[model samples]
Target: MKTVLITGATGFVGSHVLEAFMAQADPMLRVIAACRDRRKLLPGFAGEVREGDLRDADYRKIMVEGVDVLCNAVAWSSLWGHVADSRHLFLEPNLALIDAARAAGVRRFVNTSTTSAAAPEHSSDPQSEGIPRPLWPHLCNVVKIEAALRTAASADFQVINLRLGIFAGRRYALGVLPILVPRLKTHLVPWVAGGRTSLPIIDGRDIGAAFVCAVAAQGLADYEGFNIVGPEVPRVRDVITYLHDDYGLPKPHFSVPFAVAYPFAWLMEKLDPIVPWEPLVTRSIVHLMEEVGVDNAKAERLLGYRPAYAWRAAIHAQMQEMAVRQTRAMSMAMPIV
Candidate 1:
């Protein structure tokens, strides 16, 4: 049996990936879930579980042993920290994992990345190639990670990088939506450039399918990258309006031009040390909103990846799940008569 070691198996994205692999019913595949908290793992997951920080050398050493494929879905970031902090928090540890995987003779390594790695400033055609801009911390790190993946690829090993679109699902806890939803309810979020820009969003379940495809893809080059996105490309306005209409929340009534918003975001970031929570907006977020639609054709052709959910349907599902959770919470809080 081939052993696949999945790091960050407890996170939103990682959990979905784990679910996909387990559901495959591949008798020849043995999955090993490596995460800090095993309790957070998906229910009824009958797989090998290893618990520890990936940064710990001993932990990584043990996790990579006898592993054929290493699927990395781990991510680390702070709402109010220097962009350079990403080097220590993300890049360093992941690079270490690559080394460990190589030393342990892992046959394949799959990395989960963001489509924003190829923002407009970096590439006119993100599907073919992307030049990472150094302005944003996340983009810069993705560039470095891609470079590392290329360098690590050899005759014996293969690398697959899935550049994923903005994640949309009930399990999604990070990114723009989670930050903006509550603010929109209070009428605190603003429309950037009248919210006309296209926002590429993919359901987490589809992302999981993409990871499984990456693992099973055959005749692939030593190094390959694919842009993973949803079936429909929705405008920023449509997303905000959907939230407002579906949940009866206040929509953004005002607009902020990029020029004005970027400076304000920079200033807020500067004041991050004293700020209690993340700023309402940031330059990176603005840049992401400005991106054009992502092309998933390459993924479809290469990995046979056909997205199963439309943006509207995915958002509706998330809203319904959120409502159900809220109702359950309220019901539990009420005193039993």
Candidate 2:
């Protein structure tokens, strides 16, 4: 039987990945989930669960032992924490995990990366091609991680990096949407460049399926990269408008050009520490707005990844889930007779 171990199995993306593996009816596949907290493991999960920080050498040894494949989904995510924190909290741990996986004789290692790594200059075509420029600090760190993985991969071990697009759907805790939602409630978000920039988005479920494909794929190079995105690319204006309309909230009326908005976002990021809450805007968010489009064709051709949801359908599903949760919350809050 082939054994697959997933790190960050309790996190937003990781949880979905875990579910995908669990749903697999393959009796020959043994799935294990690793996270810091066992209590967070999915309800009714029957597989082996290992709880501990991957940074600990002993814990990593236990997690990788006899594992045929390793799916790394953990990240110390903070839109405000720029390069320094990213390197310290995210880059270091993940790179170390890669080395450990390689040494442990893991046949394949799958990593979760972001499409923003192809920033400063993006392509409109359906190909995974771009130059890495230091436009966004978070993506810069991802680029560094990708380079490290490439260097570490060998003929005996394979590394596959899936550069995922902006994520949405239930359990999505990071990305611009979570930050933008609250501001949108108060109509505080501005229409940067009339919000016409193409926002490449994918459902969390699709992302999980992509990971599953990576694990099962064959004849792949020792080191390879693929762009993972939704079937349809929606403009920012459409997404924002859909959110407002779905929730009966006011839409943003104000607008700003990229040149003007970028500086303002930089200033907001500078003042984030004292603000106590997340900044209404950040330089990283601004850089994301400049992305034209993402190509998922590479993933389709290479991994046979076929996304089931488009941006519109994904957003609608998320809003419906949110409404159900709100109704349940209100029911719980009502005073009993």
Candidate 3:
């Protein structure tokens, strides 16, 4: 029986990955859920659940015992506020996890990374491979985690840093999609500019499947940085249009040049460095207006990673799910006639 240890087992992606592994793997596989709070974990986790902070040496030592694989999904997923903890919020805990995993004799390690680290081709920065600065602290953790994994003393543990594109599905962060959906339905969220930026979206559930595949793979010498993107790319404009069509709302009014959006992004970034707890729009989102499509051929060939949902279908599915939720809410709110 394989023993798999998962960090961030309570988070959006982490929760799904835990479930996915349970479904695909043998019932005998020993799964350990290592998280900051075990009570926050999803209902009916079929394996051992351990409470531990990723940053603590003792926590690592306790959780990694007899664990053959480690999956890192822990992160600061806030949108704004808490600029002071940027370093600790991302780098410290992530670095600690990588170091501890190597020392613990874990055979395989899979780390979650977001696509925000990739620079657009038009970016003026000279260092293409080098991680760009001024990144959202959560996303920056991916880069730092990857670098740390590379430098870890050549141990038997093989690391796979899964660089994920925008992911949506059950329990996802109410990112651009959720925010835009309600606004577009009410005609509040505008397209702003042309909404020309192409978005590479991957289903949150499919991301779960990807992690399962990573765990199932026999060896990991060739498995490294792979961009997990949707099977097809969808422009932001089309996404908004689909929302308008789905909800039968008036087409969103457009204004505010793309250039103007940058300053709002700048202010949002300045106000919220680690996670934008409160902001009209944050830097990570501002960059959303910019193109972020990625090639997933490597992931396809390596991990047999294929998105289970299409971009448009996935977008509509999200809106549909939200609609069902709203309907339930409305039904519950009615005067019990």
Candidate 4:
């Protein structure tokens, strides 16, 4: 049996990755899920669950056991934190995990990266550039990890870095969708400099499937980095409008200029350092209004990868999940009058 170790096995993408392996029902597969909190390890897995911090000195002792494959899915994805703290959150833990995995003689290593690592300098294609792009704080950490993994790549262990775009599915962060829906339905949202920025999106299900493909492939086979994203690109404003039409919500109302809305977004960020409960018009998201699409043809030709779900279908699924949650929330809360 081949043993596969998954880090961040309890997070949004990690959860799906775990489920994908379970659904396969492969007898030769033994999954070892590594998570920081034992309490977050949900039921229904036939494999072993190890609880430990990835940055710990003893991580190798705890996780790098008889493993053939190691998935680097752990990350501190918050928008705000001290730079030093952020670096520690991403750099140290990831670096330690990579060292441990290599030490364990893991035959294959998969590192999940973000497309934000590469910034677009200029682009004629509106879908490609000329927008305010948010400087992803964790991007440096990803690059550092990538560099370390590349240096360690030898005949002993093969490494593949999967640079993923904005992922959507049931467990998504629900960051931009709230702003999109309200704007599309009620037409009451302000435009972030005309909202022309194109954001690349990939369904989490497709990302999960890609991991399975990676495992099946077992080696890089002449490929190193792959951008895991959808074929078609959509602008931020259009995404909201599409959701409005799909959910039968009120059409969006774009009134104020994006620059005008920037202060409110700043205020929201100041008030809520954590992810905003609603989408705030910010410079980073404003850049998303410009093109942030990826070139995913590499994954297609090499891994035979394809997006399992279309962007519209992904949105519809999210809408359904949101409705269910809202209904449950309303049911639980009695009228305060």
Tell me the whole-model lDDT of each prediction, alpha carbons only: 0.78, 0.77, 0.67, 0.65
Evaluate residue 191 in candidate 4 and report its C-alpha lDDT on the 0 to 100 scale.
56
TM-score of each: 0.89, 0.88, 0.82, 0.78
Tell me the tens digit of each residue's lDDT in model 1 across 1-337.
8899888898768998999998897999999999888888999798899989887899989989999998898876433345656676678889999999999999999998877776765433433445665447656777788788888887788999888888778675566665566667667668889998888888889988999998888888888888889988888999888877877878888999888878888886678679766566667777778765577887889899989989887777676766655331111011111
Give the TM-score comparing model 4 with the true structure, all chains together.
Answer: 0.78
Clashes of each: 0, 0, 6, 14
- Model 1 ranges off by over 4 Å: 79-85, 122-135, 273-277, 320-337
In candidate 2, what are the lDDT values of residues 222-273, reduced to their tens digit?
8888878898888888888787777675778799999999889878767877
Candidate with best lDDT: 1
The better candidate by TM-score, 1 or 3, is 1
Using lDDT as the yardstick, the better of models 3 and 4 is 3
How many clashes in candidate 1?
Answer: 0
Tens-digit per-residue lDDT, 210-310, candidate 4: 78777777345522777777767677667756765666766445545555665666665566556534333444454345454566686777777777777
State the lDDT of candidate 3 residue by residue for 1-337, as single tens digits: 8888888888767888898887776776788888887787888775788896666778777878888888888756534434446456566877877767777788888888766666555222211232644545544555566677755625476777777777777765535565544445555445656777777777777888888888887645733667777778787777666756766756758656667876766775577546624444555666666665566777778788877778876666666677666442111011100
Q: Which stretches of candidate 4 lie over 4 Å from their true place?
A: 121-135, 178-189, 218-223, 248-279, 323-337
Q: How would you order the candidates by TM-score, starting with the best? A: 1, 2, 3, 4
TM-score of 1: 0.89
